[model samples]
Target chain A: MTTTRIHSTRTPAFVEFQASPGHRRPVAAPSNVDVAVIGHSGQVGSALLARLDRTTEAPELPGLQLREGINRSRHLLVGDGSVNQQDRNPGTLSGLGARLLAGGRPAVIVDCTADATLPRHYPEWLRAGIGVVTPNKHGFSGDPELYRSIMQAARKGRAPLNYSATVGAGLPVIDTLKRLRRAGVKPAAITAAVSGTLSHVFTRLSAGQPLSEAVADARHRGFTEPDPLEDLSGRDVARKLVIMLREAGLSQVRVELEPVVPDAWAAALPGQVDTIEALREKDAGWREKIVEAQRDERVWTYLARFDGRTARVGPVEVSRDSAFAGLAGSGNRISIESAEGEAIDIHGPGAGVDVTATAVLADLVDAAFLLTRKG
Target chain B: MTTTRIHSTRTPAFVEFQASPGHRRPVAAPSNVDVAVIGHSGQVGSALLARLDRTTEAPELPGLQLREGINRSRHLLVGDGSVNQQDRNPGTLSGLGARLLAGGRPAVIVDCTADATLPRHYPEWLRAGIGVVTPNKHGFSGDPELYRSIMQAARKGRAPLNYSATVGAGLPVIDTLKRLRRAGVKPAAITAAVSGTLSHVFTRLSAGQPLSEAVADARHRGFTEPDPLEDLSGRDVARKLVIMLREAGLSQVRVELEPVVPDAWAAALPGQVDTIEALREKDAGWREKIVEAQRDERVWTYLARFDGRTARVGPVEVSRDSAFAGLAGSGNRISIESAEGEAIDIHGPGAGVDVTATAVLADLVDAAFLLTRKG
Candidate 1:
């Protein structure tokens, strides 16, 4: 194991650990806070590390010390700016969280990986009084049992666990839902265009582009996953829908995914080239559907809809003048209606490294505030 | 003088004073918390009181006790469900803040009044360690010096002062702006239609209704103020813009209001009949503009724009295919663009007694959370 030491030149300013404007003050200004970044070498993780690197100068987050940065092959320490090769990989990062808290200071772990196995460690870290902040959806959306345990652990140890970036990137979807629930206003329905990758592809298709070409365009624009099949399968949007339903106070959530791409084609795909060829094979079907929508003054969009009981995601036709039709490239829109028929609509970019990094940093600050108050 | 005692059938459950989903826990479950309502006789105030009345059974806010209910003519206590007329009035309610904290319990004041005079007492109450939550924009949008003092007092006494309802009712405009600032992202520009009354009237005009009929219809639908001039003058939206600008970290804000109704007509309006007649006289001018917009395939809307330095509110033309033109009757919309050009658009109803009351209740919960942590 490689050990790391982070020395923040500026004094730790816990006096500024506030949620609102100058309102919250901890009992004492804490001296040190250790932040361990798991998977900090990825795109968003590296952006977050860069932001944290500037915290000594940035007033938004005053004194967050980046204790360690762990990736696939190495765990780099910040002090002395040292880098070392790790004998073990991140799959065995079970005890790293426990070691972070050995100094008897407040510790927070930022999980920036999309690894499925990493979420299993969240409950342990949270129950041990270590804060957990993540933009990863696997933890909450993969297994419903895991979601319950994570929430339970946060309550048991009184540690803040924030994953606002899991669903809508930088959008306030989760926080808004929590606020509505806190005020005794339950949502009756949720209609959303959540996946920026699919949104971009379908928008191009609506503009008379070929399906294969649109997929390649989105891939070149960095909107799709390395494997374009991941974006075409509709599973990504389905996971987001599950997370949203649970946040909307639904105890038992079952989302039915009707993928725009046929499930069989996505399942048996071999490689990226084949994925493009497969998309080309389905061009005629999609073109016919698009022409039908055009004839009826409608546009096709991939949408996730939840009406109190049922949650479904698939390609749906909306009026040409509707908000969904007006969504441009890489945009996300959600219309949430309350039990009383009141509605609020939010629209913004759903995918970006900078905005997503900002969301993670915001969560880190909130976690730090929680730890400060604990002291 | 009359003294009121409030009893909660449920135990004071301070453990549930959480901002997230069961993530925050106070050190101790406080025994009692007193909530004093000032100006509880008005429309929103009465709705908030009714919601507080249901708190005994609602799990959202568990055990907040209503200690005092003060209107212009009387202050009634809740003990034994008694109501009595008082000799003294509310204008002299200077020392009530100190008295609420006399019992050694946590105290919070919910200001539901639009009264300009009551805000003068906010700093005293906040500095006394009593939380202040209000839907009243008068406190923050009035004298700039008072805004500074209220914020300073909140810091000095470490008490929460929340005014989220001041800007977009329950639409999360202020909170979103604060979040953007906290993430080190300052908005470059803001374009908003924040007044529901004005939005309704303009939408009606765009649909070819006469200006006088539109104003009268809005007033009859309870969308306008008691005096139509207040909404017609564009002052209401200007106040909201000021609050938004201040929250956006602008130190000095000056708003130039170009009313849809002519300044002279709104300024010297004698009564509602004259107000309607004055609107009638301006019908041809508005009709000409509307016809020109129709010819150009555009729609007119009252908009508030802030471009970092200058703040202006006036009538503007938007393309018929744009979101501003798509905004229906009584809907509010705000688009905030960050310095980096990232944008988030929020649309919803900006006015309603129930939603505004809900916003106040949400703030009350937040204040309760803050006070609970202090104990």
Candidate 2:
């Protein structure tokens, strides 16, 4: 700090402070990286398309309204002529060309599909060293073996798989978990209202709405999945719970979901939750239960929770003071307890085209920055 | 969509899916970049060192416990043999070396000092293409002209200046605002509790505590700056507001801050709050005011707010139902109004070393990733 003084006529550049090699060349321009957006027909998918196309209709896509100014992908292949939301076979999913699957240079794929079969191709993409940015939860919250496979793929590909939008849309659940893990704080417990649709139902039902009405409203407003019953079955919450647990370092915990409903109705429902018919409650026990909980000043929400030794997903009765109480429509809330016993709560809008698209856009930006590392 | 079915071998490598120029070699392992820690003796700087060294004794740091597993940067320079916390001369600041400034290749300078003079060196470093990551507020919120110089330097250097930890520690306020800006959502308004020390004081004061006791406690725990008056003064909050407004694209807005003096002390205190003697209210009117506010079920906290047309800072009374009613200790909160009327509230720990260091580490990671661009 005291020996390297060189007098200059003009204001000396700060570069004079560091050990700059005066003979080196400046960095070249950004690489010729291409971007391929798969699943371009869905809600978030369409919004991304609107953003890329410089249109104004993606109003529902949270941050899409502001991204038109700085979009840098020069070669944008939307669906590569005919890709759809359901194209999941290894051959079809892998056929988006090297820019999406395998590239000698850095490239990216904005995957928006919810197809369960697509996760089967994650390892291949990873192995090929292609970056993937997606809101699709299938690849992350699926089989525990697959989760490991995805991670291994990332290492093998020497590529980043940014799926921050998978767990809680734009709520930053994944990033926060990663930071907590990075900080050496093992999360002792993570309790979350993970299903935005279910949360919408609970928050509304407490304010004097029928269970069916709340579910229908959430579905009509596009808060629920394609199917309304998916919010009621507790499977979605269970998937999110497993992902949270895995992020917290409990990679082997497999949680077999117990439906939020009672045993009588659970038996009558189908293995799937794509329809209200699967929730066969003749006396409307679900509605009555919600109203009953409200009367006791207890808010009932579909909670996905893990406490180190156990992971469970079900409707839990929380006091009015609970972080989950009075959660607004389509909002997600997560409260994590560190090993040190201090708790941190992070809550935000968990779904909707805008929130999910903005999260996916964030991943896309990460992929863009990482692409310079041409593996 | 029927896809191209060209599968002759076992799970055709997704790598086979890309247009490979068989001539190119695999990416060389992440570049030979070096990292320099400028303020190694400080709390956050030491915590970062502990993380890089894989040690376990950074109890004051928020996230060092989790980062030990993945700390990379092989050529680490703790300090340039003579840099101290308060050395502010341009000659001293610029002596760190090329790797910390204009490197032959990509490199990073992790700035942790709060020295006002250090920011003057930023434009020169940025102009040289050296990456900058920090929690320091001086560079971003000092003079409007300097802010412009820094941005222009980033473009000139083709380097990134990441200061996400500046305004909200690890709460992601800067990132969120930038995202909103990118999405073309001109943020209409932003209201925040930017002072964790003041927030903590208000929260505790509402629960029955003397002003002096609160100040002494915060001082003892290192919540306030070395000078307790720094927390009482509105300077920190005002700086944060300017940064937030600039992020929202209001670069020209000049805010005249009115300090958070309670009604009883508004007319009694000196122009500056750099000493406890300045808070000489013989009857303890300040304490009684907090008590009176509590009686009305209203909580009071220092607030820094901007609503596009105006920016202000002061102690404001918020009802029990308001989000600001009970801020957690040393935590920050920001509520943003999008171009639309929707309000988004983001709150988290704002002042702890761990929180801020983790945030700086995130920017460090970003700088590392951006280095692959090779300016």
Candidate 3:
């Protein structure tokens, strides 16, 4: 009988296996992924699934099959005659099971869940060589160390991990940064108006609308978070900036976030009034504040900067004709300034299911190519 | 005695070597080059040579000793002791013997020349595993097949070729593009207000100066080409756009140059007058044409685009607040519309010997790294 003792170190499980005797492993098998949706029930998730279902197969990957677990009870299996959808949770495959099926097996995982904790699974899935497409910003921006770890795992495992949907929904800020880096240009700074919800509210306020009315209008347009305050408080912009900063190689830098909470929110119990009602109660005062800004010819913009240190800033007033000015609707604008030279600006829609889904799909295609090439 | 037969094909010479018994020969001794400038003697060349001479050890290869033929001459050697005041015939290796001796060995080449034909020597040098750094735009922008051939030769020969000075004199556009590509985002389009000379003229014209006066002012400031028409005609910007396009994989396509030549020079003899004098000689109608553009509140900009197809435009009117608007002095502005659905805009100093030389040095560092890594 052989007894194998494992040492506890920070190294990966596979690396630790070096001490085991005579464990020859087979080369990873090539995989052909047909479909992958990370957040099965969310807005972006459903949109991606529908798009995949509608796409006609091409020669890039032959005999592609959407591998839903037999335990997925709610997913309706389409195109191919296979196992019953009512029998299992198609999107809930265990790490080992995902690896077994997606390892050397072509597969994609499209993550739409906003749950910050979901990204912890990225490294495991990537190590098993599964392509990950996500709209979750938390994985890439929440912590720089972990973000790099995930990237390293993807590289070591020869998998693709794409997250274009993380910032600016459908806009390609991440991709733009990657290209700039590839071309050998380092960004000096990034000035981005990245929150669709925030942009909408700011626009309404600039036009003399009360902050509460603007918040309500943003909600009607599906631009605001459920609590409304999430957008108004500047956290959304801060999160997006952090993601950009990480890509810019500034990791773990503290991001200073100043609450842009309405005046009434300061007086009300944090949990008692939803952000929408608080802003509504302070409508008169907020209107006056906005009017005063306009009288001074200033444009209100939520700006962030990653200036070689921590990402910093909050809602600030910029002069007209400045890059940050004139943004409307749910637009996202990003300007990157690097040690190399002047800033590079990127702007487009920051939210929208279709655009976000398209971005995710683009990432999936990129991942598919990466995996296939590695094989 | 063995009979030897050498056969040639359309492919590069080094690629055709045979290892068969009768044809096999031992590889030659590797050549140590401290620098390998692609286009070695033009405006940028003179400054580059001066910079290298002042900074590096005469001409010593990184670690190799100076061999007799290799270091016999210092002044005549490429990138040796100093920029020679006298001009030699284009093809001859003039004071190479003295130059080679002054410098321990030629470790690097500062390519200030912009000739397309210069790249023909790259494959041979690369096969010899020499390192090359250049500001020449042609090597990266010319024919795609040729560019690929050069890249393949460099890869197989384990050589390093760097050309950061190809796109934005010293702005780091190429470096940025490379990073973006590496990060998994492909550029969709590239737009730029990219000429110091053109920008100066445009600004002058916008300020109500006559076209002729603007051209003269540009010349006085050393921003115009020796034949200012080249700058005025938008050919320079076209070349830059071609470089960016090729980097983005549109290598096979030729950039269609839409001549934006001033009306006064449209039918003039090539050598009839300096661009400034030629514009001055224009009929009163030309001045009227200039005033008309300004009346409409438009600014003239030399613009180039790679919208899936290579195209160049400008010295035409573009409205204020557009991407090309508001470029000051000799600054360069480049807007890259990436496949990731966003546009990246970069602006900075477009011309200066020191800046361009710095860019060339950056490329040299990059080449050094590539060579070391391959080794």
Interface RMSD of each: 18.2, 19.5, 29.5
Q: How close is candidate 1 to the true structure, as a TM-score?
A: 0.85
In the range A1-375, model 2's lDDT, one tens digit per residue, is 011111111211111000111111123333444566666666787777665432122221111111111111222223425432332444443465443434344566667778787667777776776667788777777665676677767655666688878787876677767655444456777778878788778788777776667777888887776766556667777767766766655655556455545444545566665345444442266667656666876666667766666666766667656667777776687777655444556666777788788667767655655555332
**Chain B, candidate 1: TM-score:** 0.88
In candidate 2 the C-alpha lDDT for residue A295 amounts to 80
- DockQ measured for candidate 3: 0.04
Candidate 3 structure, TM-score to reference: 0.67
Angstrom error of the Cα, residue A256, model 2: value is 4.8
> In candidate 3, what are the lDDT values of residues A1-375, reduced to their tens digit?
001111111211110000011101112333456555545657776766565532232222222355542222344344447544553443444543354463346666766778787788788877766777788877776655566567766654556678877887655577556534323445666677787777777777887778878889989987777777666667667777767765543443567665566334454557666666766766876566666667776666566655554456466666654657667775677666546454444455667776677667656665664555333
The TM-scores of all predictions, comma-separated, are 0.85, 0.75, 0.67
The residue-by-residue lDDT of candidate 3 on B22-109, one tens digit each, is 1011122323445534334445655555554332221111222212111112223323334343333443333332343355443444
RMSD of 2: 12.7
Give the lowest summed-lDDT range of ten residues in model 2 chain A.
A14-23
Better of 1 and 3 by DockQ: 1
Candidate No. with top TM-score: 1
